[model samples]
Target: MWVVTGYAEVSTALTDRRLCKDSARLRAIIDRATAARLDGSRVAETVATDMLNSDPPEHTRLRKLVVKGFSARRIERLRPLVQQITDDLLDAMVARAADGTVDFVDAFAFPLPLTVICELLGIPRADQRSFRAWSTVIVGSSSRDDLRRTTTALGGYLAQMMSAKRSAPGDDLLSDLVEASDTDDRLSPLELVSMACLLLIAGHETTMNLLGSALLALLRHPDQFAKLRTRPELLDAAVEETLRYNSPAPVTTWRYAAEPMTIGGSPIATNDIVLLALGAANHDERFPDPDAFDIERQSTGHLSFGHGIHFCLGAALARMEAQVALGRLIERFPDIALAVPADELRWRPSTIMHGLAALPVRLGR
Candidate 1:
């Protein structure tokens, strides 16, 4: 595996057609590495067939079919809904802060985005809690048994949900997808299930981590936090800076070299599994004092959401979510502060995601 860390090189690799995201090719490379022909489980294989694992025109088609559900207009319409959710969650947090402390991760960060995505997908409120456990294992676990178990569970749940949507369609994203599949065959059954899984996982996981990491960064840097509170207009810049400083998605999903190429003057052979370190590239010499957490800095061009064609489809939604969640949190809880020492916090164990395991904050401080 080749790891590309330089900003310029990683940026180049993101768009270069020579690097591909075809899952079959990736599996072939893995098979060669392990010296065995390994067939993934049905659930695993179906999940891997999402747009995130395909190349154009397959990726292009899949993205087109799903992008309408997350259009700018749709996301904009969701702001009021997002604000309501944030306010409700904050009310609960205030109620729970009788002891003056609350785990922001549980109280606000995780549920805010999760609720939005779940509602958009028409998932019942009762079933929303179970997703946290399934998502944690799907993204963070290293054991094959753990992964298989979690994916099977998630996939089975989605299959049942899609089946229900087919019989009685609802005014939800999943129903629209089901209609598309059943009407024109634009989406196969496996593809529909895989896409739903992708939307459920990717829709909330990255945004959840972004909220946690953003709060952690602000709390750790009092000056920046104060600046945000005083000059509320800087909320967007603050979110962008947090994305560069501690990107939720630290590294991108795997990319394979379609042909021999040189990135950062290093030779990458065909079929080499390449990992682009978004976190590292964001801290590279491209920006002045890249290590400094300056909300006022020109933090544009950061590859936290990635670049080129494969850039995150939920970028607009995630940005709106962070801005709304953080802006309201600071406005409401002016006395919020870290409950424990900054160094005492621990990040979840995941190579691809950067997020705090827990963010204990004194809401009344």
Candidate 2:
């Protein structure tokens, strides 16, 4: 495995066609060593065909099928809805804070984005609970059995959902995806299911972490937090700085070497998995005083959303969601502080994402 941490090298490797997204090559490597039964499995079908694991033509087609729904204009229109959701969650947090403490992660951070994504995907609000376990395992599976079991279940649920969407199409994005699969014939059933899983899971989880981490960053830097409270225009910078300072997705998903290639003077053999450390790259010296959490810092060139064609599909939505959530949070709980010592905070153990397990806070009583 080749790990690229330098900003320049990570950026270069992102656009390099030599580094492929095909999971089969990497799976072959694992299968050879462990004798894992991956071939002809439900997990294999979903992982092998997802847009995140395919090269051009396939990726291009798959991405296009759903890109229109996430367009800047489309996402921007959700601002009012996002603000409403943030306000509702904050109201609940304030009510809970009557006792002088509340778990921000559960009350606000987790639910805000989760609600938005579920509504966007046309998933029933009641059924959203099933995703927590499945998504956690898919992103941070401890073993092959865990991965296989969770993926099989997730794939099955998505298949069932897509079937219902076909019968009763709606204004939601999943309905749009179903139309593309049935009428336009642009997406296969498996591809549709995989896309739903990818969009629904990736859509909310990363943003949830961003909300949690961004809030944690502010609480740690009260000066910066106060500065933002006084200067509303700095909200964008605060959000950007938070993403650069403490990235939500710590690393880009695995990219396999399609052929022999040299990245940042380091030679890589074909089929080696290339992991780009986004958090490390974001703090590279290329950006002056990278460690400082200066919201006013100009030129925020972070790979938190990645670079090249595979750049996050929901970047605009995530940005909008964070901007709204953070601004509303400060407005709602002006004196919010950590309920426990900062050192006591725990982080979720996932290589691909960096997020606190819970953000306990004293939303001023």
Across 114-184, the per-residue lDDT of candidate 1 in tens digits comes to 99998889898889899999889878945777788888889889999999999999989999999988889
**For model 1, what is the error of residue 209's alpha carbon versus the real structure, in angstroms, after optimal superposition?**
0.8
RMSD versus native structure for model 1: 1.2
TM-score of each: 0.98, 0.96
lDDT per residue as tens, model 2, 304-353: 99888999999999999999998888887788899999999999878887
Clashes of each: 0, 0
Model 1: residues >4 Å from true position, as ranges? 35-39
Off by over 4 Å in 2: 33-40
Candidate 2 global CA lDDT score: 0.86
Question: Highest TM-score, which number?
Answer: 1
How well does model 1 score by local distance difference test? Answer: 0.90
Write down the lDDT of every candidate, Cα atoms only: 0.90, 0.86
Extract clashing residue pairs from model 2.
Answer: none
Alpha carbon lDDT at 98, candidate 1? 54
